[model samples]
Target: MHRLIRRPKSVERDLDILSSIDTKGLISRRELMRRSALFGAAATLSTFGGVLSAAGQEGGGKVTVGLDSGAFTPILKTFAPEFKAATGIEVEFASYPLGNMYDQNLLALRQGTARFDVFDFWPNFVGDFGPFLTPLEEVGTLDELNFNDIAKPFQQLNIYENKIVGVMIDGDMFINTYRTDLFENAEEQAAFKGKYGYDLAPPKGYKEYRDTAEFFTRPDQNIYGLVEVTSFFVYAFFINQLVQLGSEKGVRYGELFDAEMKPQLVNEIGEEALRRYAELTAFMPKDLAQAMPWDVGRQIFFDGRVAQANWWTDMPKGAADPKISKVAGKIKCARSFGDVTVLPYGRAVGIAGNSKNKEGAFKAIAWMQQSAQANRWVAETFEQSLMDPWRNSMFDDPKSTFPLQSESGFADNFASVSKELLASPKAYLDISIPGTNRYLASIMQHVPRAVTGQATPKEALEAMTAEFEETTETYGRDRQIAHYEEYRQRMIKQGYWS
Candidate 1:
């Protein structure tokens, strides 16, 4: 049965002081860590039954969640009955289209409507949604929420201004997937080495990646070098390359913006990233200019028409599914090329501040994420769910299963590569300050110009930079600067390079 495990009164007071000191910028990072550790210990030693009784005693109630239409929605619907049976809290969803999810959720919160007790949102929306959501720490202690179980990169996504703002429900980092049959073929390897002057293997850098793509392209055979999402959400793909390029060039903070909030993409590094991006299109499908990751990208890869694909973790799992993929056992996974990999999109669950049933909402979130059995079920049902591994236990535990673990040759390999990628020292977090969606939308608008030859890479990046500058000014430069500083500092503390 679900139980509300509240922090002790003394620990709560200490947390308030800690939060205040952190907010006022009066505490050093090291000291903050020390105090946080002590507080964690104190809370763990405290009681878990003082605030509320067991779910059986609390009686039946309802908790409505705000969600977008996606793979996650169906999973939640499937598991709702289980949660209700166990906790007596009926799970209901207020579904919205993905395109308008942010607006609908924000409108409800801004109006203090209490329309949803819980929200399933993109983690990048933390800055905009933070004030309207209750910190999970207040709903439950770190121990109760199993905070330490989450991966380091995703752990940082849950925190905003030192408060635990949400819990990561999906681990959506970009990974490189390729056809092992192509790479391992004796004739193909020999031919590649003879022509490129090096042994053929999975690419480790941009130069090798480009050469590999060019070598594999054979239009007459219906084979191409690569496939990637290039429409609508294309900005994410662009950022993936841009961040790695910046990391390789030793650009500061991975080169999205400077300390003063100036755009960094109007420079040489940005141009080169876009140029390489555009060049790759030559090795992709003819219709790639309008491809989306969910359909075209996956369809092309699954049809075994492409040798390589850089996509979210879902690609490897989907590739292994024989029902939808002709390349089932021929796939392999690795970190995206370069010194660092970018985390593009992921979902997080949070309780609404205006909810009358905050306790029930936290129970639902905890049930889905903190419960070991439930979490494993979600992660393993990859074909039916988009949830990827975000917890250490999911990978470290021998008994934990992945999609088609016994049947798919690459299941273990994908898990291993995912663990390595998430823990990589050079992994870059996405820009998640206020107006992050708008900032990314600007890139989406300008990227097509470069990809379609309507504008040069420099011209496109210059246009994007101008839009970024205008957005910063529109959002109030000083306010955005403060938000970025706090966001960057948090990322630094989490081991991401500046």
Candidate 2:
């Protein structure tokens, strides 16, 4: 029988393991197999509970969810009915501003209010809630759920001391969204290729990225190159880049307790990465440096005012709308390249540690992540599902490949980038340090100095090292170092390092 063949689109099912490519370097085959074996076991266990699929649940009691307001409203609302029908549990959903949603959730969790059964959290806040979240391993073994199919690095992300404590709800991996209309022109493409000795594509490294930014920067046309966010998300993105510059694990070595964990005062490579970040952004418009620029940063690209943007998956949708996006037909997507590395961030979900409804909560959390709810959400919302593989089937979906009145170039570009991201093995990282919020805030202030030629990279690294040491010490270095060690071992086990 001849099977129908479909082409991949920017919105189609992705084949790239966008966040899975490990850059910690080579390791022994035996170790590689060992980690793979553990992942295999977890993957098998992920799908073990087929008890009540996302079919629909009914009215038992309201399980409240504290969620950040996002574009996936329709999908989220749709799931409520399905979940209610399947489990007889009604959902009481409350939306919050992104700023303090997690903090609010934690406050409620710590107070043992049971006001919300589930809380929506970004990866940065996962560490904050780790101590309070009930490990998923307690409710369902990794063998039961087919965890491997979800995404490459998510299961490992939920782990704390061998316990799988969370379930991933979205596949929000980072990618470079570029303006193809500007780059695809024969003259522009030729000029870029001639200058760079490579095809005119989204940047593959920091130097190229900077060059492209400068190349496409036509301020006369109100267009800029290399648009970036300087918010909390930006800091996480910065951390990822820092890892790419350094050896395995970058500035964050393993925990003090872990054998693989080493205490390092500074990583020169990481310092350089931060320096580059600040230098690039120093040329950015001043208003772009605020704590909330990412939300509006994509509009700069969508309006055809910027040549390229470094942002998460949600940014592309801004360009999807024809009215708002002058470059709706021209925008494209790809992974942000650097030394061919993928440092995973923001692929975390965890249960509250002090919940009375542990069983119900686990079931609810697992249902949202494992069932059709997650896959359909991506299909309908055009948002990248959390940083994982649920979108794999959507790679070539018809809806993703629609030939709209807009140019096909945008779709094609996005498709190519998504494919590249999905094809690689994912590398996961933790931002759940006890004082990550404060540390990142400080890094934001100081890292820019180094990038803008104010401080040497070594100076920046020393400052960061000192800041981290001070904060971690105050927040309990022993505990924080333990988590760092676990993170390091995880990288080693994944063959990110020898």
Candidate 3:
């Protein structure tokens, strides 16, 4: 049978390994075998008592999931057998690479082939996927699941046009984490105060953040201030930084667009955000543009080469792993240094509108969020896991932390990460109207252009605006405007924007 997930020809179903491709595109044999061993070691039987499984499931030969290749995939492998034993439902995953998953899922779901029962998606693309997904609330058996426990910002993403279409799977947002060893050093503190007129600490706002980054730069020592992944989620670095420019007064769409759906890319805030976004690359490796954004960036910090790295809860979590990080106990998680910290992109898995088995699919999605399950994934002894702590309760487990980190206690050390999550009183949802892919695509293609100084920030924004307008026109101007208006109003109602 043909498979949707692209994998090695020699790799087989029974092999039991977690795999990854390097930047050069060669597969490492040792890493694959290592992860496979961990997969066997980490999983536990579900004590969900039938609530997570399909006690009332319909015909269940196999239930397919349109999944992305991420840390979460391996976690699912651990539980798949338990789910099968409980519900008699075999799990088949039709997977794709991270960036490619959205387009492939769209292709699979749009056909009448019943290709996927459920698909993983980001909030930013809800508009495109909205039509293809079933309102999860409409699925009767899922009613008892506590919908309110999810973070409000995430709640904003899953509810589109007032219908709950997806389950909150990833609380992927930006949070600045810094080297406490640097910040707490008396000599560095005196030097920072002497140079910048302030005590060295985690920054509370934008200017301080830039200054803090600048203060830590020491290229002669091979130490730089900050590094952000340039290749994939660079767009997030763009959005979150720009959003902070207007965050204090509660800007509606941040720099996404004005109330009129006009692109706001050429403004003062836009230029500064772009400049600051590019400015950090100065202290990074010459190949900063090629650096892996999330997990691997942790290594750059642990090596003591950089003072700060920020994005996603996963970074701080993974940084605490003793086996991998030399600076494991030295990092501290904190709030965005500026105003807004909104959803630039996040994962929210949902049942396909065209799925032949909506009930079984909902069960699987719900299963992942069960309190016990959520904690296991977040606190999984392995340093790198598929998902982050999306639920508030994930942090409630006081004892769930690295073995070496028990000295400070998990609660005290983790306060910063959790506080960062709730710090943003307001955040903008990614524009989720039709042609969202086109809308974002227009903007993303210019990220490296403007940041690398190849294009003036103005030129980049103008180029993006042109593309945005073309996409808007192609999607029908008036219809999209109405949709945009509806979206803004909904965000206001949901308190995403004041």
**Total clashing residue pairs per candidate?**
1, 69, 2
Clashing pairs in 1: 253-498
Lowest summed lDDT across 10 adjacent residues in model 1 is found at 43-52
lDDT of 3 at 198: 76
Which residue pairs of candidate 3 clash?
Answer: 71-386, 72-386
Which stretches of candidate 3 lie above 4 Å from their native place? 1-61, 248-250, 253-255, 289-296, 381-384, 401-411
Please give the TM-score that candidate 2 achieves against the real structure. Answer: 0.76
Q: Where in model 2 is the C-alpha error above 4 Å?
A: 1-58, 71-75, 141-146, 193-199, 247-267, 286-292, 340-348, 381-391, 394-416, 422-428, 449-460
TM-score for each model? 0.86, 0.76, 0.84
Per-residue error at 288 for model 1, in Å? 2.7
Question: What lDDT tens digits, residue by residue, belong to model 3 across residues 93-139?
Answer: 66678878777888877998778887788887887788888998888
Reference-based lDDT, residue 441, model 3? 75
RMSD of each: 12.0, 11.6, 10.1
lDDT of 1 by residue, 188-267 (tens): 99999999999998898998899999999999999999887778878878887788787777765365888899988877
Q: Model 2, residue 10: what's the lDDT?
A: 32
Query: What range of 10 consecutive residues in model 3 has the weakest lDDT sum?
Result: 18-27
Q: Which candidate gets the maximum lDDT versus the true structure?
A: 1
| Candidate 3, position 422, lDDT | 58
